[model samples]
Target: MLCLGAADTGRELCHACHLELPWLGSQCRMCALPLPNDGQLCGQCQTSPPGFVRVVAPFRYAFPLDSLIPAFKYHRQYAFGRLMAELLVEALHDAYRDSPRPECLVPLPLHGRRQARRGFNQATELARPIARALELPLSTGVLRRVKATASQQGLPAAERHRNLQGAFRCVRAAPIEGRHVALVDDVVTTGASIRSATRTLLDAGAGQVSVWCIARTP
Candidate 1:
């Protein structure tokens, strides 16, 4: 079904609206933070290396996406979730032609209490379609969020990192050793969460871990 106000006869979004979306142009090679120059690491990444080998975020977390993401995540507007996943797949196909594909896709786990309240793991929902499209295994339980930390939304970078300390653990012996893994999420903010989660995967014997997100905050 077409969404309300969709134009161009039979598209989910009209050409103009699509053009107006906050698509990322140039981004940091390491963290996918929006950058003025392409193929360069951001200052933060240069000073302190991140756990993930690379990050891929096709959209900027701004404008329509900021509104759309909250609606999908907080209000259970699932259509937006599906739309965002499809968009990420399209972007990946174009950007990752020569990049190494991960053997498995891991959705960043949410704590049980948070998952119970939210009724679903948004990251898992986002990764399911991507896994199907890419023909890669989706491991939903291999990585578990053990501690329920305070929300990182308004927290500073230092605080965010501290909040996620000891928050993630590997629950299953899933043969992840020497295998590339892609951690999927809806957005990459300060990247503290990805750092903590990737640390767990790395410590658990993942050969290399990459982050795949729909959007990143510039």
Candidate 2:
């Protein structure tokens, strides 16, 4: 679909195009931030670890992804989103090969007004295919974005964290309590949003939380 050329069998992205994508390399094991060496934690993660146990992202936010992700996210290009989700599913399979799978998948919630304006929550849409492929329940009602704060985009890291304070609340703790949950999103930048969501889940008694995203900003 991207190159107007025939895709590989059972794949949305052709192999040639896929080879050229900016795949992540030498990332921090905990946060998936790009690092000089593999299997090490970033300074931020070592100094103050995030609430989530670990992050799984297959691509770095660069080049075509910088364009493709925004197109899928803001321009209503759902086909592109689906392609990215498929790629994420593949990564999840690999990431979970040795690790325990989460009991449920929770897409980061968008505020009601934002969902109304966008006509859909991008994270929820991205999680649907993953739920089916991974055979995990999609728990949409468990969390809600009660506060509609300013967008985290373009904000400094500190400001981003402040914006997300009190942004999420656990609406249905019964499903989350004592259960391992995978929080799903399209991209992770400053990680302030996911950190807040993770705290909410942990506070609700979730056994553990992991982040799953299509891309991560380097």
Candidate 3:
């Protein structure tokens, strides 16, 4: 309720703030990129498909979300992370209500050095409560980010893919074999990271992989 930000309001978000958040209205089925229609693939996905079968994101990367996300990730303001996870869970319940839930949740891993610097993997923090609420197993040990790369924020789309090549490895194949897996992350931009991570899961025998993230950049 709006109260999350205001003690007196006690609402998820105040009406004014809620109206200002960039909600993703219609999005591509494959990449969760903003689209003219909700269930259709964007032209780019039609030409060059992503590895993950579907992506579900609730918000657009804009305004206050852009600010709040960094606070959670860089500043360790976990209350923001908890609130984001709660919102993402609510979105998932509605989006996948009729679909088969993934067998387990695999968080997008952070490189050991990066995690040491940041003090936590933001994706793991986001996924833990989601797995608990969904009654799904969380397999953090299944995936590993073996390579560290520069931040992808300003890279060209093609460069982003190159930066993440060989960045991820499937460390535990048995848990995901023949299983539908949901790869969790906090944000998806050009989708290079999720696509690279999903390839590892699929190569290791995952039957299918879907992406779950809080925000997507159009």
Candidate 4:
């Protein structure tokens, strides 16, 4: 679907275009950061691990994904969002084949002002189909972005973490308490946002937290 070319195999994205996608290879076991080898913790994770247990990402943040994510996130391109979600669904199937599934999926919540201005939350849109495909409950009210912080783009990792400090709060503790929850986002760049959200959920009594994103920055 990305190339608008005929798909002989009946897939939305043709084989040629699919081959061009920046698929993630070996990665850190925790944050899914690209690494030379797989199944090992990265230095960052070893020194100061993220609040989440692990991250599941299928693609690197490059090329077609870099372009496609922006269009879907900022240009209101719902078709592109759906396509990415479908790809994530397939990844999640393999990811959870031997692992325990989360009790619920929570999309990274957008601040009220941002959601109002955008008319939709891209993370929620991406998580909806994944939740349906995985047979997991989608929980939107579990977390809320209380502080409307500055854009994280271009900010260093430390600054990004400071920017999102206290930005997220678990409004409904009943559903999250002692249950494994997966946080969903379209893309994960330094993972500061995910860490902050996971911290909030854990503080709210969640037993464990995992991250699910379509792409991770290399």
| C-alpha positional error of residue 169 in candidate 4 after TM-score superposition, expressed in Å | 0.7
Model 1, residue 101: what's the lDDT? 82
Off by over 4 Å in 3: 1-12
Off by over 4 Å in 2: none
Q: Give me the runs in candidate 1 sitting further than 4 Å from their true place.
A: 1-11
How would you encode candidate 3's per-residue C-alpha lDDT over 106-159 as one tens digit per residue? 999999998999999999999999999999999999999999899898999999
- Give lDDT tens digits, candidate 1, residues 1-218: 22456567233667677777899989889999898999999999999999788898889999889988898899999888888888888888887798668889999999999999999999999999899988999988799999999999999989999999999999874657779999999999999999999999999999999999999998
Query: What does candidate 2's lDDT look like per residue over 78-117, in tens digits?
Result: 9988889998998899999997899999999999999999
Overall local distance difference test of candidate 1: 0.88
TM-score of each: 0.94, 0.97, 0.93, 0.97
* Candidate with the greatest TM-score versus the true structure: 2
